[model samples]
Target: MLPNTLAQEMPRALQHLLAREEQTDMTTLPRRSFLKLAGAGGLALGLYPSLASAQAPAAAGLKPFEQPTAFVQIAANGDVTVTINRLEFGQGVQTALPMILAEELDADWAKVRSKHGSNNPAYADPLFGMHLTGGSTAIKHSYTQYRELGARARAMLLTAAAARWNVDVKTLRTQAGWVLGSGGRKASYGELAEAAMSQPVPEKVTLKNPKDFRIIGKPTTRLDAKAKSSGRQNFGIDVQLPGQLTAVIARPPVFGAKIASLEDGAARAVPGVKTVLRVPLDRGAEGVAVVAEGYWQAKLGRDALKLQWDTSGVEKVDSEKQLAQYRELAGQAGPRHFDADMAPLANAPHTLEAEFVFPYLAHAPMEPLNCTVQIGDNGAELWVGSQMPGLDGMAAARVLGFKPEQIKVNVQTAGGGFGRRAIATSDYVVEACTIAKATRAAGFNVPVRTLWSREDDIKGGYYRPMHLHRARIGFNAQGQVLAWDHTLVGQSIISGTFFEGMMVKNGIDATAIEGMREPYPLPMRLTVHHPKQNVPVLWWRSVGSTHTAYVMETLIDEIARATKQDPVAYRMKLIGDKHPRHRAALQLAVEKSSYGKKALPQGRAWGVAVHESFSTVVAYVVEASVKEGKPVLHRVTAGVHCNLAVNPRTVEAQIQGAALMGLATCLPGAAITLKDGEVQQSNFGDYAVPRITDMPQITVHVVPSADAPTGMGEPGLPPLAPAFANAIARLTGKTPRELPFKLA
Candidate 1:
């Protein structure tokens, strides 16, 4: 039996598709359409021919795939099917994972097809012991397992073919999905697949060395590029179901506030309006949903509904007030210490002090939060673009009052995640399920889809907490950095959240204190954390490094200025001579950008910053000019230490994209506030994102290393902010401490 949620919708979804097919000519249907229709027709056809009998069973007592699985199946034809366990959210895992398997299998690349694996614990990353994809672990975690599985499959096939020819297995070699022996006698994998399945599974398999890698390091185009470019990709917004109703939610203006009461007469009177129900915005829930026939109609109805909210707790909280509190907190001595304090500044010949401020920011991904849910008496199913599929399933179970096994989650490709989709805080999925349950209870088998407008996404849930850092550095007469003391004040990102148990301890959130503690060769260094309350903060892309990098790199520039030393050489000295990766990245960035060569056209100046995150060291040099005081970045040159790059082209794309994103955060972008607790900026027009016109000419150079691949998504974000700020300092001869620097 199918789970109750899918069981309830199965008949309806099939009937809808059948009805549509009848209106069109089946002979003229496209191949993709036929595949979609066949899959939806409940044929139970396995993508893997070997798994034809292993159909996903009814609610049996099987454990989920918690460790990643690699399964290859060869059909009667030459088609080779590879199953990938990770969710593909535009991080290129779909292509990258398959490349590893194909390289080891020696399979014909042209005949290979990919399929998404079932949700089972056996497919989880061995490091995390759960089926989750985040933290830049996708490629590194899957590297060995994929290769081993492919090698094992190839060995089995070669053994089967060799036995038929009565030859030693060592004498047979496989290439292009074929097994070959002496005199060029060969058979395709498809011909030997059945016999291969009968062979004993190998207890040990040998993987190919990097020196023999044929396709692993090559720059192959993304497999989904054509589909995405043609608008054929199926994101959550594109999911449609029979009798599915569209929903829009009415959220509280302030975070953690409640809806006291609502008058829904006007909303109910709107065309296509169905129902307006109150839902909880609790731990695993969002606000009440207004369900209707279409998204626009539901939005109209929600806007027409008059609702009163209880804002007692958050009414007095505003951005300005939060800034004031953070500044005060930064000045006080705190109990939590990340590093030992430097001995008092007695007898120091030179001292430098500065304060830097970072404002609260939102992720604001291109596609807002949304979910399509169908609920029944025994279970619920959700379609969403989620990073953490396991968490989504758990949240669905909690919302529906069912066991985790009763919920099914179908992951979709996201327009942009940037860490937002990984978070369950918004609780949009739970809210959609709740609406579906309520609608079903009313005798209407309504499939509900909830859509959050861009405005709703901006003001909802946690934000990157505003931070303030105050630092005092004492230098000796020889300009050798003697002592450093830094205090960071910000809302703890991990406290009072689901991630608190894993990343926070003793009132200190590691993300909030990221770059404050350093391993550099400083004599006396003290890192202090002063935590703040009343602000809801979550991890944004680079987390605390976003603000921490800005503070640390800018301070280094100040020290270099005070000592009258060249900025690049000064940083090279302070970073010590032993760390080769940092030294290599810094040196490459300087050489590639021609640092200190010809002083960027007249009034323009150049600034440099470097940081290490997710095991990748990146250095950035930015050239900017102050126009009437506002800093205009003209060009950016960056060097990345990705070690051995799986795809240099993709790495370059990520670096360039992250550089532009960080530049936006430094100047033209900010989430604003108002006295009445209303968010002043809503939608793209008000909450400005960097456009093509705003982008600078970016050049990214990848430093090759044979080491494991590091993260490409977030490491590029930390350097751009500080690099721009330092350039501004050089241009105006004044250190700008606050973010979104206003020239006028």
Candidate 2:
């Protein structure tokens, strides 16, 4: 695989692509078929060339994202349908994205609708040239792409109206889906669709200025809100195909363990059971696939099957032992990422040393993994909610022994993915394809939907890597840092994946130490250790910021407290003017939350932390108290600097959800552990997730700007835990050393 930079950089690459399109070539038709299909008087959703980049080669044609025929379809009744390229799990891309296109198109808000796209090359990220929804890049990267598409389409409609009315194109203006011309002559976009679509695709189009934006910055309700709240949304798991069969697997007890023997007589005898076959699983393991007419039937068949696993060669991966090993590794220097002078470490007026432990965490999406595969003699089609549809399609084709183009992936709305559905290895998709193929070989050539129970999902691996952070700092009475040394020990999420080449440098994973000494110019020596582990690991919601931000911000707070300084003012002084976004966000939070001026109710104390991730910055000011030995967060005030919030409602909702997820990390029992090669927690009963009762009243505010928006999803998460921890530290003299806050 070719090396690719991280996802957050995608939008900057788009600027280069647009630079080439600046020289308009209006004579060239994007594709011959697009015109022919338009002449045939039907809606055409044809493919366009990809935007060329270092990692993504172009197809030598008009850019797919610049064409409106593929993304927008105007019905006769003026209903504008926009197809989003990224998966909409819970981020509100379905509505937030359409609001972008519709803004430039000047379409009526009520008439606009949105839908998910497929694995088509045209739907791949304009810059990344890959199907991706992670890293919070959806809105950030595609904002300008969709704007140009809408502008070009609107321009075409104006051109068509000018020709029809026998006037200059410049004389016509568009408003709310209508092309308005002189003498009260006007036509709806739907009325001019066929004629306008046949017009040559423009290589150059003007974008609306931020001052003129009618839809971009407005706080609007999500397009899917009513359906979702009304229980009318059809998620991937709700898919039903004719004669479709459901399949469930009995996985190995340990990672990489194989099936020793399987007794399937009782399973095959179960009602509604069609077949049972032992199949290959991810990570070189083996499991028995039970195929039946329904989910319950398949589950019953899987339960009845008597299976044995080979744990002889697999690693048991005891949690306590792994933590001990990580701690040992932390003391040894392997690779240095940041080198700074440590001469002042031993001579400083004051010094502090702290070690923090974070355990493995499961994604635990609300919808357990499920994929529907229908195989034909020549090709196959898959229906699933995937974060990486192109990669998933390729994995399916590889497993089915077919060409990539022969497989079709119909991306669907997901309940919630967090990060599980975006697996780099395509583990769950590959497993589903393998099971479908095995079922076909057993004389059942039908569509099969593979489902994982809640237990299976919780116990299934690919957890956020367990991590250990050790930091030693030297400072003065003024809270000025003299020297700092930090070490991080964790499994590299990119070590074995294709990203290893680009993200891992000189034995250190960039992701493992991403948020170290950022915003503040601290003289720090940072060392990293990437130890190979048997446990399957992947990126969580905020990636490395999950632990790094907690360590950095809480330590910063500690230093401020030790020196008799205000946490907010100390952070401001350290950040200075180098990071204006961070300063703006922190200031916004302080002002909104009344951080320094207002005194909280007797027990409550103010906590402050600011962090930047995925190019977005979020500062949180929280009020917290210790209630009967546990920390209780009463409220949260967030100040976000994501440039421009295309939809403030979406931005606010994202912060709310991210803050809640961050809070879940502090709740008791919120961990995944291993013992004797088996997962100790199977479901919500043992492994904890935040309940409604644990929710804190959250208020979100954004530092507004006209610049393009940055990522909002992951950035909101990194600062939440640290701010909450700081508040707890104020209430109690001791700072929490680990997550899930083991308060006594």
Q: Highest TM-score: which candidate?
A: 2
Which candidate wins on lDDT?
Answer: 2
lDDT digits (tens) for residues 565-671 of candidate 1: 88888888878876678889888888899988855699888989998766678899889888865688898899888777777767777788789889878676565
Q: Candidate 2, 214: how far from true, in Å?
A: 0.9
lDDT of 1 at 218: 81
Candidate 1 wrong stretches, greater than 4 Å: 1-81, 113-118, 163-166, 193-203, 283-286, 313-315, 376-378, 424-426, 523-534, 672-676
- lDDT for position 598 in model 1: 59
> TM-score of the candidate numbered 1?
0.87
Instruction: Tell me the tens digit of each residue's lDDT in model 2 across 613-728.
Output: 88889999999999899899999999999999999999999999999999999989999989987889999999998989999999999998999888877889989999999999
Q: How many Å off is the CA of 14 in candidate 1?
A: 40
